[model samples]
Each structure stands twice: as C-alpha cells, then as structure tokens.
Target chain A: MEDTAVLSEIESGQERIDLIRKDFPILDQSVRGHTLAYLDNAATTQKPRVVIEAIKRYYEKDNSNVHRGIHELSNRATAAYENARVRAASFINAGSSKEIIFTRGTTEGINLVASSWGRKNLKSGDVILLSEMEHHSNMVPWQLLAEATGADICYIPVTGREGLLDLSGLDDLLSERVRILSLIHISNSLGTINPVTEICRKAKEKGIVTLVDAAQTVGHQPLDVQEIQCDFLAFSGHKMCGPTGIGVLYGREQLLEAMPPYQGGGEMISNVEYHQSRWNEIPHKFEAGTPNMAGAVGLYTAMDYLDKLGRDWIDEADRELADYAVNRLKELPELEILGPPTGRAGIVSFLIKNVHAHDIVTLTDRCGIALRGGHHCNQPLMRKLGVESTARASFSFYNTTQEIDRLVEALKEIQKFFNQ
Target chain B: MFDDIDDLYQQVILDHNKSPRNFRVIEDADYVAKGHNPLCGDEVEVYLKMDGDRIEDLSFQGSGCAISKASASLMTTLVKGKSVEEAKQLFAEFREMATTGNIPDGGLGKLEALAGVYQFPARVKCAVLAWHAMAERLNGSEESISTES
Candidate 1:
C-alpha cells in the first residue's frame, strides 16, 4: 500500500514529469505539422539530450582506437570504453564487469551466442526449447544453428489466451536431450511479459541453460540477473534511449569462460606468433576490432539517465498510461486489442475490423500519431494470432495521458472513415 | 487533431473500402489465382470466367486495406466484359499508373484517383494486389507478374 502511494505521487509530480521531458529534446517537436505523439516506442525509444551529447563529447575530445596506442587520446578512449562495461554490469546486477561484452545490438548478440556457444555445446540429436512468441532475430539464428548442428528445435505451445506461452505444455515439450531453453522475456508483438524468473528456475532444475531476450523488457522493468539467475541475457542500446550499433550480452562468468570466442580479430587476441595465437579473456575475447567508442559513451550516459529517472516510477507511469489507452480504445467497437487484456508491458497491438493494418498506420501517420504496423518481426506470433499484421501503439516513460487520448481520437476517425 | 489527413481520406475511397466489389467467390470459376503481400499479410484470389477473348464473369475474395480492396473492387468493374488482350493492356496501364505515378500515353479515367498512392512507396503492393491476381488468371498460373511499379 505504501509502495502504491509513492508510485502515485511520482506519477502526479510536475517536477519529475518536466525533468523527464527535458531530457528528450525530440519529443518537443511535431510531425507533419502536428504535435508528434510518438507511440512507436517499442520499436525504438527516442534518445535523451544527455546521451546525444555524450557521443558528441567523445568524438570531439577522445577520438582514437581503444587499448592500442600509447597516446593520451587512446588512454582516455580505453578508460571510457572499459567504464561502460562496469556500468552495464551494474545496470543488470551481473556479478562482474568481465561478463558484459559489447556487440552491434541485440541481433548480433544472439547470433554471437548461437554461433559460438551453440556450436561448441550443442550436438546432433540434442533439443532446443523455444516459445512461440520469439522475434525473428531470436528464432532464425536458432533455426540455422539447428540445421548446422543437426539438432532438433521444439516449441512450447501458446494457448489462444492472449497468446501467452502455455506453461502446462512445457513438461510435454522438455526431454532428456533438451540442452538449452531460449525464450523472450517480453514479447514484442503481444506485449506479454513472460514469467521468466519462474521459467529460468524450472529450466535450471532440469540442468538446461537459459538465454533470456530482454530486448523489450529491460528498459520498461527493473531486471536483476542475480534474482532471475538466467545463464545469458541480451538487450539492445537503441531501445533504451541509447545510441544505435551498441548492445550488451551478459553471460554468467563460468558460462562465458566455457564458451569459445565468436570472432577472430586484432583486439580480441592477447598474443600472436607465427605458429599459434592466445586469445584475450572473456569480454575482450568477444569484442572484435575497432569497437563503437562513441556508441559506448552514449549507452553509458543513457544508463545514467534511466537510473536517475527511477525504474519503478517509469514502469508505473507506463502501465497507467497503457491501461488508460487500452480502456479507451476498447470503447471503439471496431478495434480489437491483441494479447492478454490485462497483463502487458507498455505496448498495445490492435487491428480495426475490415481495415488493413498498413492502411490504418498510413492514415494514422497522416494524423501525426506515429504507431508501428505489420508483423513487428514476429511472423510466427502473427500467424498464431490469425492476423497478417496489426497496428501497435507502444508507450514509454516520456509519453503522456493526453497523447493516448489523441490516439483514441484518431482511431475513432479511422473507424468512421473506413465504415463510411 | 487529424485535420491534415481529412482531405486525403476522400469519401470515394472510404465508400469503396467499406463495400468492396468482387468480394465473393464465383460459383464456377474458369481460372483462379491468388495474390499475396508478404510484408503485410494481405491476400487476394481472383476468379475469372473467360469466353474466348472476352471475360464473361469476374470476382475476388480476400482481405487487405482500403487501397488494395478498393483496387480489387475497381478492377472487377474495369475487366468485366473486356477481351483477354484488353484486360492485359489495362493491367499494364494500371501498373504504370501505380508505379510511375503517371499514366503513360493517355489518361486513366476513374483509376486516376489512385495517383495519391504514389506518395507511399510501401503501399504500392496494396494498390496492385488484385490486378496481379487477375494477371495470374490470364497467364494460366499463380506465378507473380512484376510490373516494375
């Protein structure tokens, strides 16, 4: 009860609201001459001024290759880059900074694990357990890995109830040959937040290693690796107000040590001779030549911004805003909201009866309400939902109740316009 | 709030979208072809009854947005009673209009309204879904007909 009151206070506070808005300058602008109500936050969140400035500062002051040159600029760049590793470790509550390796983004992180760890660990006849709600990034890599390794891939079926993964179906799907369980922590299409902590606990009991794709959930909710105890976790920087082309892969120290390096390049090698070469330890071993130094600085600054905003407060605001939007949208008879009606992240996926999602998105774009349309990189989930595509309105901490009302207004116009 | 779009969302397009033509399957179809847009999951299957060179009957059944459905509706009106060669020519003209944003050679009467679609490159598939299905029927198979549009 006390927690609820504090959350309400945080939501209603004007200072806190203004502070959050002030951080993101792009939110102040308009689209198509109308005030932009950006509801496509799930695809990628708008970066704050602090994050953008950090990248600028790095490029202006410390522009050099990291960990190589004896010059002052190189030392400054290396220190800043390594500092980001420590920040990422603390962000997810990982055991050590060495467990955090930077990659291009979430897609690259998943591919790295699938190519390196999957190749070394999985064998022919082994099974990999996946859920039906996985993004194409999470699904395709595993499919390719299974084909290459001659391993069998199985899915945990989702009951038609808001497309939630059926926990009851897990026992039937799991087998003695099942070596790994990879699932999305929060579904991008359905907005269903899976019970990953419980899922991770169960997988551990069966001696199956787990990989949690937190691409959608990391910024929306507070995540603790110690609490979840998942062996590996991956998320992108762009989706969390950070720069593009930078992401983090958090692996258990022991698991990372057991896996071989993904790519062979200059920075990843410790020593080289004519006959043989020695690889650098864990984090550096995974990161190849000439990393995104400016991106790393921006990501570190984005993390600092998120931390200052308070995760609990942001989550509360997003939930309230989503609930309000969903309820208002439900009032329109033509719109059908997808996924579990009550439990979800900040996203709301829906389709207007007899209206194409693309058409709805196009019309909505003309209204300056930026929403995502189509399968949202989860074709399988779209198939299961019996929809070719849906218009998704995803929110973030910066979104307001008034913006949701604007979406509702535009939606009403769509129903009337299409029905006419 | 959506005042800017009020002009673009014309009444005719909305009316066609609401009550689309050729929306039902024909009882006896001489040839049938399905058109699919993989990006957005829009699908249309056209059924045609050809009487030698001229079309005796035409219909379509599928789901998609206003542009695609309206295009399908207009296609039924355009191709009904036209010769097979004339239908193919119309397909080429429509393809030119949709892709290049301008009708080549001469004017396209009712189909000229679709010129608004040229502004949206992603929506070009929606405008041509039905025409492609009809072209498949004329060609005697479900193979895709790329219009470069």
Candidate 2:
C-alpha cells in the first residue's frame, strides 16, 4: 500500500488505533497475567511487522557476508547492505552516503568519534564540553579521551529545573580553547529538548566541532542534518523501532576523511602490504569488518515504516500522548513530573512522594507496565536534579491515552500500597 | 501473580522503612564502612561501636529502596546487642539464605521477612547491601564496597 493511503486509512477511521497497534504483535500479549502496556520505548522500541519481516526475509533469502562474497547471495547481500547506507543517509539528510558509517550502536558511534577524531584533534590545553543532561554513552568516551590527551572536560551547566543548557556562559564556555561541544539532542531521563541547531551555530562561529547524540529524537521527530549543520550526529536504530546492535554515525565527509580509522580490519582497508596497510574510504574506513547487514536491512524497513506513518504525524501524536500523560498525572497530587511542564517530546519522568523508583517499577510490572527506573545512564543528571532515580515512561506513536491511563491508575495503587 | 510482590512488601518491611530503628550515627564508632549499590545508586554507611569482642552499639545511615532501608533497619535492631562473632555468624547465614535460597536451620527469625527477596533476583543485592557494609567493618577490608563487585 502507498504511504498516503495507509496514513489516510489510519486517520479516516473513528477507532483505527487498533490498526496501528495490531502492526505490533508483541504488544497484543499479556505480562504477568495482565494486559501489556509497554512504556519503555526509550530503552528499546517494539518492532513492527515490517521490520521483523524484513529481517527474516533477509536472513532466509540473502544470508551471505557482504562485500566479499563470490556468489549471487554475496552480491545481493552487499547490494542490500550498501543500499541501506543511502536510505539512512536520506533518512537524516546527511551530506552523502560517504559520510555515514555503521557501528554497533550509539555507544560505539560516540567511541569512534572520541577515539578517531578526538585523538587527532585534542591537545593538552584544549577542552571537551558536554551538556549536564547527556547520557553516559556520550560523556564517558570524552572523559577517557580527555584524560588520555591531558585535555579538560567541562560541563555546560543545566540552567534550571527545565533542564535546558545554561546559555548565559555560551561565549565563555565555547572559547578558542574548546575543541568540541558534544551534547544530547533530547535528554532521555528528563525530556527537555535542547536547541542543538542554535547551539551548533554558536559552536560553528567559534570554529568548534559539535557532535549531537540524537538517540532520543530521531524516531519521534523529523530530522534534517542540513538544518542542524552539526559536524557529527550519533543515534541508535534500536531506540528508533529498528533492530538492536545497529547504529549510525553521521560525520561530514571532510571530517571523516581527516580522522584516523577507528578500527583496522577487512572491509576497511584498500591494500595490505607486508608491513603497511592503506585504509579504505570515508565510511568503509570507519566500518572495520563485515557489518551487521541484516541489521541494516531491518533499520531501512523501520525508517520506511516511520516515514510512511509520517515523521510529522508521529511527532504530533507523541506530543499529544505526552500532553495527555502530564495532564492525567496531575490528578495524583503525590506525583511530581520532571522536565518541562509542556511542549516536550515523548518522555515523562516522575517521582511519587516517599516512593522509591524501583518499587514503582516493580509494582507496575505486576500490572504489565514496563517502566525504566534508575539513573537511566544519566547519573550526573540525576545528581543535578537532587534525585537518586526517577521512573520514566517513554512513548512512540503506537502508544495511546489508554495506556497512560493504566499507568496513572497503577501508580495510584502503588502509592497507596506503599503508604499502607 | 503479584502475591510474591505483596509478600515482598510485607507490613513489617513497610513499618521498618517508615520508621527505621537505630538509624543514626554511632558517634564513637570503632569501625565505619560504606557500601554502594551502583545499579540502584543507593549508598549505605554502617557504623559499629564495639567493646572488645562484643558490639556495644550499631547503626546505619543512607537512603535506598524500601527493601534496603528496611533491611538496614531490621539488621541494626537484631545486631546491636549480639557479640561481634555472633554477628559474623548471622551475616554468613543471611548471605547464604538471600543468595542461594539455602535457609539456615534457625529460620533467620524476623530476618525471614527478606525471604521474599529471593524471588526477585535483581533485588537480592538491595537486601544484602547493609550486610556487606557491616561485614566490611567487621572483617576489616576495604573502606568502601560496591554490590557490583
């Protein structure tokens, strides 16, 4: 079916949410003898039929090592794998397919930039600045790299309770000595959306490199790298309704060409001498061995699925869900919602009075609601908020107000249970 | 299905968490040790005031899940008057019970409230964090320990 037709069908019906919900088979089940209300999209999204079928079809039909296969299967595998690069490139509006490289996930993508670009550019007196709200995946690599290079790691303070960056010291922070400004496009723990385009523009004026961790934003929003114009953006496919163990690092062609190859192995080399080996081109140089080809195919289908639903449409739905969730949660006076009160993305982190996050998650799981409770790989942000942890419920377009209602009800019972 | 959860969050656990016993600093503590559960971001400090081989007073200070807080509370209540060697024996038995489901012959008395903890593997560490800190001070090892270890 055409994108517009399927989208119109979804929009046309009075109660066609079941149509979209039915696309996800796993969500139809029960957990712990209760109906499933999965709210852990930030951790990993539930895969759609299209993504699952795409992955299965690839494995059943085109199972071969890419780039070096001798038969038809190998050629088909290589073509499908490389074609995914183009789709992904178009997905993010990257400059070219040459600028996109495949990696294990957001973790490896950041490590690549830290190990490759960081090693080449950072010096003793230079600084690597990160936002206070960044996930550990984005912060840890820079910390290790800064230590290795004797460069300093400083934070752009969170301005207020909203968790926005403290832009008052922008000029002081992004100085001549600052080499990189790596920040989150959207915080997973607190759902504050950072103005990366504006931040990137400032960093550009200072001639500083900027890397955006878009792990939380890509699936729910319509992204355009040309608009942000950051030097690099890293995101994971698993968080975006695709398969796990696959991610993308989008670097400018010139920057990728300048950095050293992150890992040296087979698909990343041009020639192997007895003592000297020449590296491959921009992406291949960065992607070392045979890549996760089926993962690429699945991610391509996942993006196609999102595009068909329409990124703008999904974003609007997610925003509505978040708005509804906040409004519903306000009924519980004991609960305090974190992040902005309104005009945020798909996540809501909250805490109930005198209730530990782990206990909330445990009780909610009994009702078949999956919530993330802990520092959420954002210990620094948790400390900044003066909280040990908060329970987060993240949504994709497939989620509905009904699930949020269940969550609120479950939380009320949980609070009552603890008070007992 | 959540009968286990109800068991896990018993009235005793709730009461102990609401108003923990011996939850303070032993000002003249002879041994002090800290324990952290990195996964849950919980911190605990176990202080012991000993008179030769007997424990004169004991207390704990920190914040965590209800299970950890309650475990610390009950632990302090049970170990305050016991001798140092007796506390060590109880720690060994409780550790065995919590981890391996090998209940000691003595049934652990009030500490049996934690038997529900074995059903939830992820929470087993929370029930043992205070014990780890107390053991650290008693055995004279590292100043700070993480349950992750």
Candidate 3:
C-alpha cells in the first residue's frame, strides 16, 4: 500500500506538471474556437516556450558558424552546440558525448547506419533482421542496402493475434550470418512497446549488432543505452517537443570509431590538402558541414523541459490516458481498436466499421478534433492487420482524460451518423 | 458540433453510395481506366461501354471515401444514356464547379449538393477520382490510367 501511494505521487507530480505546462505556451490556445486537443503528438509535438526561446536566443545572441572561426561568437556557438551534445548523451545515458551525432532526423540516422555500418559488415549471403512493425524509414533503408550489398532482408512477423513481436521467430531467424537486428523500440502505428532488451540480448548471443529506432519511445519512456545494451539507438527531436531537422544517433563509442564517415564536409574533416584529407573522430566525422545550431538549442531546451517534468510522471500520465482512451473507445460497437489493447504506449489506432478513415478524419476535423488517418507510414503492418487505413490518436503528457472523453464522444457521433 | 452528420452526408448521397447507378463491369468496354489518390489510398475503376458517338453504358467499381463514392454514383446517373459529346461537356462543367467553387448558372442537376465539397480543399480529389478515371477511359489511354488528388 505504501508502494502504491509512492507510485501515485510519482504519477501525479503536480509541481512538475505545472512547471512543464507553463513552458509550453501553445497549450493554452484554442482551435476552431474550441480548446485544442493536440492529440497528434507522435507525428510531431508542439514546442514549449523555453524551446522556442532557445532558438530565438541562439539567433539573437550566439549566431555564428561553429568550429571554424577564431572570434568570440564562433567560440560561443561551438560551445553551445557541443553543450547540446553533452545533454543528448545524458538524455539517453550514452557512454560519452562523442557517441551522440546530430543528423537531420531519425530518417537520416537510420540511413547513416545503413550506408556506413551496413555497407561494411553485410555480405552477399548475410541477412539483416527487422520487425514487421518497422516504419518505412527503417524498412526502406534496409531494403535499399540489401539490394546494393547483396544481403537478404528477413522480417519478424507480428501475426496480429498477439500484437507483439514474434520472439519465437527471432530465435529461428538469428544466426551467424545475421549482421544486424534493426527494430523500432515502440511501433509508431500500433503503439506496441517492443521488448528491445530481450531482442538485443538474443542478437548479441548470435554475435550481431543491434540498432533500436526509438523515434516514438525515447521521450515517452526512460531509456538507457547501457541498460538495453543495444549497439545503436536513434530518435528525432521534433517528435519529442523540439524543433525539426535535429535528431540524435546514439552509437557505442567503439562502434562509432570504426564506421566510415557518412558525408564529406568542412567540420567533419581533420586536415585538408589538394589531394586528400583525414576525417575527424566519431560524432564530428558523421556530422557534416554547418549543423542545425538553432535546432540543437531547441532540442536542448526541450530536454530541459522534460527533465523538469520528471520522466516517470510523464510516462504514467500518458499510460493512464491511453488506458482510459482504449476502454472508452472499446464501448463503441463500430469502433475496432488495433493491436494489443493494453501494453500500448499512449496511442490508439482504430477503424470505424462502415465509415472510411478519410471520411472519419474529415468529420472529426469538422468537430475540431485532429487525428492522423492513413497507413501511418507502416503499409506492411496495415496489410498484416487486414486494414487499408485507420484513424490514429497518439497522446503525449499534455493530453488529458477530458480530451479522451471528447474523442470518445466524437467517435460515437461518427458511428451513429454512418449507421443512419 | 455534430448533432447529426446526415446534413453533410445527405440521404440522396447515401442512397447513391449504397446502390450506385452504373456500378458494373462493361463487357464490351472500349476504354477502361483506374484512378487512385495515393495519399488516401482511394481507388476507382471506370469502364465505358461506347457505341460510336453514344455511351451505351458506363460503370465503375473500387473503394474510396464518401465523396468519391457519391461522385462516382452521381457520374453514373449523369452519363448513363448520354452521347459522348454530352458526357465530355458534363465533365467540363463538373470540373469547373469543383475547382472554381462556382456552380454553373443553370443548376448542377443532381450534382448541386456536392458544391459544398469545394469548401474542403483536400476532398476535391475524392470528388474527382471517378471523373478523372472516366476522362482517362474516354481518351482511350488505358496505359495512362492513374489516381489523382
């Protein structure tokens, strides 16, 4: 009972909630003259005032090209940029700041690994194992790599009956020839939090490197690279309340040291001559040219906002909201929730039986309720679930139980309209 | 806000969607085409039964949003027994009505209710998916069949 009380306190940290919400001024606004629900958090979250101000501050005061100039602004810019790297390292519990390389977003991060590590390690007969629930960002890159490197791509099927990654199939698929096991930490479409630790452990036993695409999981849950023991993890800052065009690629220091640099540019090189040049070490080697300085500052501020909120508090809130939404939505006869009803991370994908997803979205929008409708960038998973499209409502900590009630009410109206 | 969606999803449109006129496979179809909106995965297959200048029968099949379904239903009702030249003229009028947000002076016939759809920019494709497919079929461009949004 004491443990339960402590859990409740951790879940409902009032001070933290007020502090975090205060920083995000956009939360107070209304849409179409109604209070904005902002349920499309998985696509890209709204930035807080702190993150917005950080971008403004960088442009106003610390604006300069990093790593090249000898002037004061340049030095400040470089320090601010590297400071973000340190923050990113601590955010994911990476060994060193050198392991955190900034890229455009998760898409670029996966591509970097596919081109650099994949090009070197994968051979003609080798296999690359990926989950059936992978986003197109994860799937397409491997497919392109496999085509170029003569490697075979294998999938761990979901089957939809269990709505979990097929661990039994993982045992059968993992072998000496399987070079890398790339999977999403949490499904963007289905919201299934995969058992990455177990998958990583099994892959390690088979002497394979693992890459966890935590695009949807990182900010929603506490993640430690050391605890998971995955070789690499990637996530986009934009999805976690930061600005676009800045994301983190967390790689093991040793592994990052070995892989070839992705792009050739000014800051990434050690020394340049007329003929050839040597590349810089780890993070810098991969981060080519002028980085997204404003974007990095925004991410830093966003991380600071999350940290102040206390990660556990946000996680619990999101989980409770998701549970409430699932339970309420299930009450509608026409609404069919996809994937495992429970164990889902703050997302619900469902189809209104007779109503087309696009129509549902359109009608919902008319009611000032925004949601994502389509394949959610996982066409293969859509096929697996025997659905062409679905309406997805992904929540964040800012989402409230009242919002879930609104969603449920909206869904019932949709069903009734279609039935009539 | 939604006391009843039947106002937007009119009874006539629902009736047309349920039992769409000209919904069948044309056996001796001169031109056949399919249109798709990749963004929404809405598809429509149009089969035209042409007897020289006059359209003997026109039919369509596929799946899509209510707008597309209703538009296809309306299209069949408009062109079922019309001449090829008359059908082309209707297509032009329909296109103008959808794109320009201005209904022609003489009422839109059965298609008047759909004028509200132009207010929704994203749904214009849903209204035009079948019409575009019909145009592709009329042009005898079977290979050029495509979905538009």
Candidate 4:
C-alpha cells in the first residue's frame, strides 16, 4: 500500500467506472423488471470478484488454523493471515504491524477498547466525550464502560439539520475531567465528514485519548492514522469491498501494550496452569479463539483491489454522485435533504413533505432501486432533527449519475401517487 | 411486480391514509391502548368507548406509513357499533387474512384492501399493528402492544 498510483484512474472517470463495474459480478443483475440500482452502499458494499475469488482460493487450497500446527497447510494459512495484518497496518499508516488487532468488525473493535483499556484507565467522575451523530456501535460501548467505571458521558452538539458539529463550546466539553473522546469520522446517516484531524489535535493538547470510528470513511478515502494523530481507530471490512466477520483495530503500540487482554482462549495465551495463565502479545492478546482465517484472506485482497483503483479517485467520484443526487432530488417538490449543504460524502438522506420514509423506500423498491429507510442506528440524532426516520441513498464509485436520475424520477412518481 | 405494489397501495388504502376516519382521541374513553412498530418507529393509539357488551364508539390517533395509517382508520370504522365478541372475531379474521392469505367465508369487505400486503412480508406487521392494540384493549388488557412481540 504505497502511494504509487497518483490519480491516474481519474483521467476518464466514466470509462473507468464502466470497467470497474465489470469487476463486481453482482452488479450485472436485475431486480423486478429493471436493472438494480443499488443505493445501499452505506449499509454494506458488494464485493468485487477479486475479493470473492481470494476467499474461495484460500478455502480450496490452504484451509487450516493459523499459528498452531507445524503442517504445511497451517504454515500457508499463517503466512497469509499475518500478511493481512501487515497490509491492514500499512492501510492506516500505523507505526508498526504489531499495532493492528483483528476483531469481528467495528462494533467488536470499539468494544475491545471500551472493555479492556477503558476499564483500566477510567474511574469515577471521569468523562467520555461523544458526539450527537455517533452510531450506536460507537456510543453504547462507552455507555457500558460508564456504567461499569462510574464515568459520565457527554456529547458534542450538532447543528440541527445541517449536521455540522457546533464546536463553539468544545473547549468546555473537553475539560480536565474528560478522559477520552470518541467520534465517527464520517457520519453514517448524515454523510457529514467530521473535522477529525482538527478535533484530534485539540484533544491531544488537552492530553485526552482519541478514537476515530472509521467504519464509513476507511473504505471511501485514504486514512493515515499517524497523520490524524489519534491513539486508536476502528473500521469494518464489510463496509468496504471485503468479506464480513473481519475488521481491524489500529491502536498505538504503547497504549495497546498496557491494556489487558480482551478475551482468553487457546490462541491468546502464552502459558497456562490450573490457577493462572500468561497472556500473548499486543494484537494476539485481544484476539480470542480461532479467528476468521478466510475472512482475513478476503480482506487482504480487497485492500489491494481498492488501492489499485485509487481511493482518491473513489472519494472524488462518490462526492460527484452525491452532489448529482442532491441537485436532482431538490428538483422535486417539498423534498428536504439532510446533512451539510456542500462537500457531503456519498450518502443522501431526504424526506418528502407528506410521505413517511418507509413508504418512500417501498415505492422506490418497486422501481428496482434499493434505498435504506430507518433511524440507521442514530436514533438520538434523528430525535434532534425532529424526524422519526429518513430515506437514504448511499453511493459507491461504481454508481453513475444516471442512477441518481432514476432515483429522482422514482421519487417524482411517488409524490404524484401519494398526491392523487 | 409493480402491480403487486400498486395493489398494496390501492386507491382505497391511499384515501384512508389521506383522510383517516375518526382520527381523534375520546376524552372519556372506556379503554385505550397504544400500538408500536419498533422497526420503523410507527405508533398508534386505539381508544374505545364501550356501551356494556357493545362498542359505543371507537377512534384512533397515530403517525405511520400508508399501510399502517390506513389499517388503523379502517379498523376503527369496522369495529364501531359492533358487539365486543364480534369485534374480537373480526380482529382474529383480519390477522389470519393478513398473515396466511386465507380469506375466510363471508370475507372482510373493506379490510380486504390490505390483503395484498401478504406479498410484502416486511409490511405484514405494519398492516396488523393497530389491530393488535385494539384487540388488546377489547380483551380487557391495558398494556400497550408491540408488533415485534
């Protein structure tokens, strides 16, 4: 994962997208009678053929448990699995491959830090700072930590509807008592790309530990953990072009070395006795039981595939799709779009005047379009925005402007149908 | 496939959703119970004013999608002026029709509009959400009902 490809793919965006679409075999299908315009990328991405093939190849050839046996199959599996760790570390620009810990996904990664590191450092009267737009995965773990450690939780306020953080009182919120600050790098529901670099800098000056939830951003953009200067970062592989049940948690080496083991099992132990057992090193100490060997192989292929396509190009193309969608949707009557007015990520959440989001989603699905409609695990933010749920259309780089046009056309038909 | 969606949101269902019948609260109701659909956050309150063994009046208030709002509106109209036992029977019949696609003999007249919802399995709960609340209240249970349960 070196910076060798310098946006060479962006020379002809549409031509390249047509070629890229061919790499994903699932895209060549129809829903109902029309071509499937999948707008649910925010939920989970469709895997490319390379990633799918990599998993199949691993199972067909090198199927064995990692780091236990002296057999040839175990050696092959161990090499592939450890290579994935090195790739994940390089993907985030971590200081060492030892800092990369494999977990189930973002949820388990955040829970690992909250249960292991949080219980050790936090005490009564300490504060855990979160934002109003955090997904439940990022918020609930800390809540459990607070309950266990007697620590209080506070939130950074979001400006209503526009979805930007109101940082006027950030200094007051990051007071001496605050032990950690956890926030999402890209909002799942609002599509707001938060100022994580600036926020992490401020937290550093105050000696507050920072953890960035990169579930939404890591797959769509280039993430450098050293550049962000955060102590920990969490992301899911499924949201990218990888298999599920495999993800990475990047922790600074010093902090991970000090934290206790998250779980105890066969692989995560060094020495075992009836009374006591010694723990493994940094990354292995947190991983318990047999890990998802096939999933790690798939994720390794996905990281390589994404880098070949260039994340910078993907980010630009995603923004272009979102801008096109927002503009075309605004043409419809009585439609209100949520999130920042400009420079939003690929997600577009909107609501019609007299239509519930569920109805809107159902109608769109009839037209062979896939959209997500719900609180999106951001119930607190939805309550603040005064909406029960919203209809969201999230884009991937493979999505075209023509799909946005189709979405706009479908929404128009829905408005007319309801109005009649 | 589009025809199935059209059947689900037919003109009758859309009209009921637009101007719901008896869409209000009875200040002095005999029984009132709330219905909730946790999946989509839709909620409805069913209020009954009983006249001994007969339902003297019935009304509802809520916010939900077209299927839910229209289902609540039609349920209130169908149960009004009917005996408690008859209303309970209708509730059971409606549930059967929505869930299993079995229209019993002497079919549900207006309530049959929601019969198409069985094709969309995710929305079966939406069509039956209000009926669950009304059935609970008529059965002398004051607890709120959730379709999830």
Clashing residue pairs in candidate 2 (N, C-alpha, C atoms within 3 angstroms): none
Candidate 3 lDDT score at position A189: 81
Q: Which DockQ-derived CAPRI band holds candidate 2?
A: medium
Candidate 3: count the clashes: 1
DockQ score of candidate 1? 0.59
Candidate 2 per-residue lDDT over residues A1-420, each given as its tens digit = 222125564555325566788788899999988889999998889988888988999999998999877999999999999999999999999979998999888989999999999999999999998989989999999989988999999889996567777889988999889999999998898788889999999999889999999999989999999899999999999988899999999999999999999998899999999999999877899988889999999999988888888899888988899999999999997899989877889899998898899888989999999998888998888887898888899998889888999999989888888776
TM-score of each: 0.92, 0.97, 0.93, 0.96
Per-candidate Cα lDDT values, in order, are 0.84, 0.89, 0.83, 0.91
Considering every candidate listed, which one attains the maximal lDDT?
A: 4
Which of the predicted structures, 1 or 4, would earn the higher lDDT when compared with the native?
4
Q: How much is the lDDT of residue A294 in candidate 4?
A: 94
Task: Considering only chain B, report the TM-score of each candidate against the true chain B.
Answer: 0.88, 0.93, 0.88, 0.95
- CAPRI quality of model 4: medium
Total clashing pairs in model 4: 0
Q: Using lDDT, rank the candidates from best to worst.
A: 4, 2, 1, 3
Fnat for model 2?
Answer: 0.61
lDDT at A46 for candidate 4? 92
* lDDT, residue A94, candidate 4: 94
Q: Tens-digit lDDT track for model 1 on A112-167? A: 88998999999999998899889999999999999999999998888773878899
